[model samples]
Target chain A: GIQVEQSPPDLILQEGANSTLRCNFSDSVNNLQWFHQNPWGQLINLFYIPSGTKQNGRLSATTVATERYSLLYISSSQTTDSGVYFCAVARGSQGNLIFGKGTKLSVKP
Target chain B: DAGVTQSPTHLIKTRGQQVTLRCSPKSGHDTVSWYQQALGQGPQFIFQYYEEEERQRGNFPDRFSGHQFPNYSSELNVNALLLGDSALYLCASSSRQVGYGYTFGSGTRLTVV
Candidate 1:
């Protein structure tokens, strides 16, 4: 089984600040996804960057497949962005996703 | 265009009892998966169902079992539950097409007393 590890288990920043969260996997993966879990426990899809870079609004993600790592970037963070961010990956196309413990982000206004 | 829908958003049951959680996948999707997430921890895969059959499963006990219907809906049944069963149970749906992402439901919060 592949292991997914997220960095900075906790993060705090001002509303207008910027930050980067990293995810390192122990093995090669064919699928990678980022999710934001709201306070009410709904997991919202953020990005599906198995590789390369993708940007959605103020958030962006980059996955270096060869290096087996991914980076999620948030620019000018908003208070609503406060939640747990999870990175999940699957070994094969049909494999189950193994998730990281997540990076809890708090954006204070 | 419903993403994923889960029933009984919250539940409370006593130890040694049985509980069942239901999930309906998003439109156009045929695969459904279940996950368990404890407080402050990331979601862990419980099992996946496709074509009305169990496809893949994680490291879960026999107490945890599930079934898939012809319409792609699924149900997770846990028997002889323990206090440790208290957690958020999430349901995700995706297409069989390779490289497709998953859509998750709000999840069902289960508490065992």
Candidate 2:
């Protein structure tokens, strides 16, 4: 089994601030995804970056597969971006994903 | 088009009871996966069903069983539930091809008293 660790278990920022959340995995992975769990408990997929970089609106993610780590950046954060951000990784030869505890982000309006 | 849909948004059960949760995959999806997310924690994978068969499973016990229908909809059955079994159960669906991401349902929150 692979261990997934998220940094800064909790975070808070102003509405217009920027932040970076990190995820480190214990082993190599074939799949990696970022998800945001809203206050209403809806898990929304943010990115599916196994490697390289991807940007969606004000949110961007980069995964360095060789280093076994990933980063999620939120720019000019909005109140709607407040939620728990999770990083999940699927190890080689396994379909199940191992998830990080998540970074709980709160963007104050 | 509908994303993943789960049944019984909320459920309450007593210890030693058995409960079933249902999920309908998104359109054009062939695989269904189940996960459990406790309060303040990330979702934990339970099992995945494809082609009406169990293809992959996490560290869950046999008490946590599931079935997939021919249409790709699925059900998760937990027998002899315990207080610890209470959590938000999530259903995610994805296409069979590689590089296909998952679509998650709103999830069913189960509380075992």
TM-score of chain B of each: 0.97, 0.97
DockQ (C-alpha based) per candidate is 0.81, 0.64
Chain A TM-score from candidate 2: 0.96
Top candidate by lDDT: 1
TM-score of chain A of each: 0.98, 0.96
Candidate 1 residue B96 Cα shift, in angstroms, is: 0.6
Looking at model 2, residue B16 earns an lDDT score of 97
DockQ of candidate 2 (2 decimals)? 0.64
Assess the local accuracy of residue A10 in candidate 1 as a C-alpha lDDT between 0 and 100: 97
TM for every model, in the order presented, reads 0.98, 0.96
* Candidate 2 residue pairs in backbone clash: none
Q: Please tell me which predicted candidate would have the highest DockQ against the true structure.
A: 1
Candidate 2 colliding pairs, count: 0
Deviation in Å, model 2, residue A15 alpha carbon? 0.8
Residue pairs clashing in model 1 are none
